[model samples]
Target: MLENGKLQRSLGLWAIVGLGLGYMTPTVMFDTFGIVSKQTNGMVPLAYIIALIVMLFTAISYGKMVRIFPSAGSAYTYTKETMGNYTGFIVGWASLLDYLLLPLVNALIIRLYLESLFPSVPPWIWVVSYVAFVTTINVLSMNSTSNLNGFLVIFSILLIISFIIFASIQLYQGMGTGTLFTMQPIINSNVDMVGVLTGATVLCFSFVGFDAITMYTEEAIDKNTVPKAIFLTVFIGGGIFFTASFFTQTLFPDLSVFQVVDDTLPEIGLYVGGKVFQVFLIAGAFAATTASGLASHSSVSRLLFVMGRNNMLPKKVFGYVHPKFHTPAINVVLVGLVSLFAIGPSLELITAIINFGALIAFTFVNISVIAYFAVGQKRYKTGKDIFSFIIMPLLGAGSTGFLWYFLHADAFIGGIIWLIVGIIYMLYLTRFFRRKLGTLDFDEREDTRAVEADVKVSSQG
Candidate 1:
């Protein structure tokens, strides 16, 4: 067993998904739709339903992979198992970028919302403060931050629930109401496919980090807990997001939030709670983004650990473990620095680039599940496992792939460039390609000569 250090071992279903997620996700959901209000016609909440289905299917594959392997590398481990190592290395590489800026962006969002609370301080300071503190706390390791995540999630949920109840009150009283989301704005945005995709692209942000729970699967009490946490978080979290959005949209009949343009934060808090919970709303936003940054940092660290261990990356950069803290210290620092730069400027491009990687990861996971079950399931088969793994993943992939076609041209072009760059780097690093995306391995376990060489090296050392 790994020692209790910065790494965690006991995260359950609820804590892993709920708390880490709550630390930063809600605001992403709100902001994405908030920007697309006119496009969604107050039906911005509906976008989450689509995101849920997409994430759920992908989660099925994740849960299956984690249950069988439960390692720290997340998709790196899963892809290696189902596909092979070179593919896994590429995945690990991509995942590094995904989580790297996650914290920085989260910090940035927290800073924006914090301005609502501390009107006097410069917003950038607020942002810097969140990035610093959240990094320090996460660096403290899994236990301390788990507790922090728990409190943040509970508080944020409670406040959101209150907002919902207040909205219900106003609705029941018939104080003021919109026509419950007419479809014109959604069908009619000038941006058309581009607008919807742009709006939905932001919606994708809300769905990105739910998988961070998998990186800690080795530490989880039971493998079953990780998958359950993932699915439930998608459902429950999606519900909270969609419900609040629906009500808030309806509360102000005249605003027409779904028209696909920038709008202020919904007045629902001030309308229903009437400023009593203004501070809480701000806190909820801050906590959500902070959690996002923390989760991002954690995932990136583990992905680097996997790559370095595989010898695909310069191992020494990630090879050192903290003597006392027991965390992957060097890898953590490197990830933070890379993420800080990524977060610094051109965030829209940063976010758009990251989402494409995530979507590609999702697409591959779906394909992996399909490949596993085809002839591979015979290697690891159970009747029930086949249905969820095979059936659900297929459905999830197929559904979300539809959404992918609607993606922004910038995202599409950017994603293509990112993958091409990764491929070129891998050829040089591995000393020329043995094969393409889905058929390479780093473990050396299956290579007769390579395995012998590893054993000889260990003996000589």
Candidate 2:
């Protein structure tokens, strides 16, 4: 039940919280607001409402899944159980791309922000320095990882809250250009439904990492708290805060600002907050992205470890957890190397690939719940089952599919390539399962007992 030398349950839960908000804040403003600006024009708040509605359905699905099957390999576990092993491999493999690439991009953002604070330093230098520090922190153990994440999360939240509070004050004084609160910014006359959906698909990327609570299920104390933690983690992302932020567009009523400049939304805070508040925004963004980056590294490496243990992948690297650190030492090191190499790639291209994989995995997770419901009916289904299994999964999958259509060609191509690569690995493993994979790390006796208990209970019911 416990990983060696972990930081205990509370820190694990707190880390989940940090990872959720940290991952959300840095990219949320930068990624989504422009499209919202474009469609709704000045009514950006409406787009946030739309996104929240979409995410709420999925977040609830995640909450239900965490309660039913709490584990680090969330999408992987459910899919493998219902759809079979190979599908699970795809989900696990794709999740690695999502986890690693996003964080690496965030770290690059951190490096860029450093240029403003310390103009003398080279961006690459800052990148390397930040990577080294974060890698060291991760290698130390989950205790340190969670602790550092906690600090960063708190610091980043304060920084963001400062921006929001300051901007809200400006509105109160009637000094800003846009509305104090505008429904107008939420609609776009120019972009069609398809365009808005396309924009929303990519924008939803910022809303991820809330389910990271599932990653710590092994480390968490009292597993029942997981569903609560997962729900809470994503709850902050709803309409209110974003609606408040959308009001900031009132300060710049021209609507031309988004096209006139790149990355326009956060500037709302910077302009309204003044120079001191601007610094806070930059600091917050960096902390958020970095925290998310490290979390991605930590998370995906565990997936690698899990895959190796379960014979889904060649276990060579993942099986080699550090005796001293209780971390995926090699994978952690490899993640650092890969992230260092990955920074300069196109964001849209990378995000599309991430979404492709995540969407498929998301689809599978929904389907798995449905499968459980189907099997549950043939085998002991409850009346509430349809809500949890069929309707939610279908809704989530349908919503995701709507957005999936808007993905870029490169992301589609990249995901296809990744899938091909996983298929080849899987093919090799299937032909030579014993030779290709390493032994699972958990105690076989305990795992078997647990699995048997579930099957037995199901049979009895």
Candidate 3:
């Protein structure tokens, strides 16, 4: 263990990618299928494609920024370093809506699954138990959390493969579409660009995990490994979503088949396979939720820790890392406590609000790339430099902005209210702009010296 409460650098590229994929929660395609399909008029796969394209561009910008400033603060750090302290605070504050609520989202999902399976039990019981277990795991050690998440992610992928195979067999036997390969799922007479864009806005929630991996940079085996992990996570997660959605959409070309539009995973499972398959599907969904809860819980805690370390939040609590666990115990427990709100809000409402914060962070991260490289460093002279520094991030910003135009009205209201609260808190923290905001210290020389001293003391003893 390192001295002075430093995050242990033990995560390799694959581990980080696993956490990212887990954070994305591959099974979410099924959870949100009915709603997105209804919104897009049965073009769920097209919505995924649109979201994938936009996320890819933003992923590139994230890659470039991580290479420059490899820290746990993610978009907040990038924006702070390039844009300014105040803008970065607002971005970070907005992002909290995404990070903070994700664990609650997972808890709510688990409650839904459990209620479907056992309607007799009170829903809050499941939420509380799930949050407690996930929070406990995260508070113990990040390595254990990563390892468990990796295993669960692999298990969830196998279930997705299983679903695809079963759906394929049914389709070949003259089921919904009677055949797999067709452009009908992508586009039909009901195809509407406006609906597809709206669905894409919601689907943007699915891609937020790729960027969340940037928070693990300080804990990664090497800072350089994080950029590669970010791309791999996005591509891998996107492929799974597109493939699964394509087959599922092809199998059921109309939303009339689903009884409950908001929750479709159980129905999809029962329809494709049988009772047995539905049981397995529920198990996989449970695994997916657990994996996502752990990853998101850990991520939000770290983000809180960074903010606390900079005195943006209460330093004594959020900044406190357990000396033995090397984990943000206080922040973990706090997030878990907040997750108890799962009993209050609906999944659709939470997802809409999450997309709002996610889009905000994505837009700013793309813009930060332009601010840091093109304007701050003046590296937009060469062809390659212009493409890498200017054009690429510009496209990223434009794509995310397009999605913002289609954001849900509830999301705008919720996001604006949250942003206002953040502004008020920021005003108080800086004493009405009289005091300057504190900055994050990314230097590692002090940590290195502390480790060296600990080693010397051990040898002397």
lDDT by residue for model 2 over 1-461, one digit each (tens)? Answer: 32322222334455566666655654356435655556544455555555566676666676666666655677776666566676777777777667767667766667656765789876678777778887887776776777777777778667656666776677678755433554445544653565456556656676767655577665554566676666776667554346444655565554554453445535654567766666666666667677787777677677766676576755666656665565777777777887785446655566667777667766666667667656654533666665666777788778767777777788888988887887788778778454533333435465445445434433553
What does candidate 1 score on TM?
A: 0.81
RMSD of each: 6.8, 5.9, 2.5
* Candidate 1: tens digits of C-alpha lDDT, residues 118-142: 7898665665555567667656566
The alpha-carbon deviation from the true structure for residue 258 of candidate 1, after best TM-score superposition, in angstroms, is: 11
Which structure among the candidates has the greatest TM-score?
A: 3
> 104, model 2: CA deviation in Å?
1.4
TM-score of decoy 2: 0.85
How many pairs in model 2 have backbone atoms within 3 A of each other, for residues 3 or more apart or on separate chains, i.e. clashes?
12
lDDT, model 1, position 53: 62
Candidate 3 lDDT over 1-461, as tens digits, reads 22237676668899999999999999999988998989999999999999999999999999999988877888888998898899999999999899999999999988988887799999889998899899999988888999999999999999999999999899999988899879998877888999999998888888877899999987776779899999999999999999999999999888888898887999999999999999999899899889999999999999998888877888888788887677889999999999999988888788889988898899999999999999999998899999998899999999998888888899999999999999999999999999989887766676465446534543553
Model 2, position 153, has a per-residue lDDT of 73
For candidate 1, the 10 contiguous residues with the lowest summed lDDT are 438-447
Summed backbone clashes in each candidate are 21, 12, 0
Top-scoring candidate (lDDT): 3
Cα lDDT, all candidates:
0.62, 0.64, 0.89
Superposed Cα deviation of residue 272, candidate 3 (Å): 0.9
